[model samples]
Target: MIFSRKIPLYEFFPKEFVDIHSHLLPGIDDGAKSMEESLDLIQGLIQMGFTRLITTPHIYGSVWPNTPEIIRSKAILLQEEIQSRKLPVSLSFAAEYMLDEKFMQYLDTSSLLTIKNKYVLIEFPNFQAPLQLHEILFRLNSMGYEPILAHPERYTYFENVINNIEELKEIGCLFQLNLLSLAKHYGTNVYETAIKLLKAGVIDFVGTDVHRKYHLDTLKKITSKKHLKLLETPFKNNFNLW
Candidate 1:
């Protein structure tokens, strides 16, 4: 896990990689605050060698309350800006849906938004795992949505119960590890948990999960050999779900 030499961030990433999780949409949740910031973030991603970006904004009910229409509209505006600027990166939109009572309502009404029309990026509370986690995963499968759990390493509740994550995989849930988590941006516990998951070979995709310019800066500085090794996995970034 120790890197004898520091590799530049851009050199670490594969040119074909497509980021499937981010918060680049302006003024929508906790991502970029305006179009200027969004543009800057996109430019950073372009410089980092990302060819396509499926920016996922937050859709938490109590806080964000972002609907599909709202998310799409913001994405359209951002897309127009990118097009006008002639940015090289292709852009799309999805949501990091918070699993709560409101999400259940959306699922019940069949109104949930998905990434690439098939994959749904979801997260639970960071402090504690949801009691109905199993039931929710089963329901998502029954409803025909491929669920990708966001940043499982950041969830402290799963630290001791790593087997819960294995069970989730057995039940068909995919895991997305945050790129910054591998850099220990969140701290040691999260970093170790991410390494554990990567070693287990359960992570299906990697994402920036970017919320601000600081995130992009951190990504540029990451030099963890473990992170580079994990990126060698056959990630689903090119999964033709889109």
Candidate 2:
């Protein structure tokens, strides 16, 4: 569906919505520790009124190393199991790629994980922004992929240099905001930073970024919070998943 760039936020979002970021793929990454746990998490999301989920399993370097093959296989398994149970929620696969040498090498070789294979979801080191990020982003654009920075508000390195977001955007990066950040799940600082981005209209999409039931539980609280009105504002695109 088409989205108007100037549409009000409330007008842009339907009561039911699409959650684009999640880690519900079973036995992958730190989310949904097992198949049973993954099913439980998606069921909870369904209860929360989300109809479509693009679950992004982590593809870190040393820690939660995940490949597209692993992600696709897991996603297919979950799809089959969910169908067998007759659950109605829709699921898709992507990866939250850690910005590292392995990923850079892959990018050079024209291989990377992305949502819909159009936007690559990437995260920087939490403590410091990488020096080569600009070059990497440029290369991604040249390769016909958009880089989506995940949870920009949670990075402490950005606390003093928030304008870096504008620079990233200028360089063709899209930003994905974690809904829990609006509820102070990370901290009051993160919540405030999230609010700033929301008001600025810099966030291109929102996601649960859910790793487990606790996250969904916290999301319930976030859905109730007042500042959620920022998200209630209309998006430019009709991303109404439900």
Best of the candidates, lDDT: 1
Q: Write model 1 residue lDDT over 112-198, tens digit each, in one string.
A: 678876789999986777778889989999888889999988888674646888888999898888988877899998888888888
* RMSD in Å for model 1: 2.7
The CA lDDT of each predicted structure is 0.84, 0.78
CA displacement after TM-score superposition, residue 92 of candidate 2 (Å): 0.5
**lDDT digits (tens) for residues 1-242 of candidate 2:** 99744322223235446667889988878898899999999888887776778888988887987778889899999999999999988887788988888887777664776676578888888778877899999988998998888899888788553587888899999888887786679999888888888888777877779998888777766543345456654233317322
What TM-score against the true fold does each predicted structure earn? 0.93, 0.89
Candidate 2, residue 54: Cα displacement in angstroms equals: 0.5
Model 1 regions more than 4 Å off: 1-5, 234-242
Q: Enumerate residue pairs that collide in model 1.
A: none
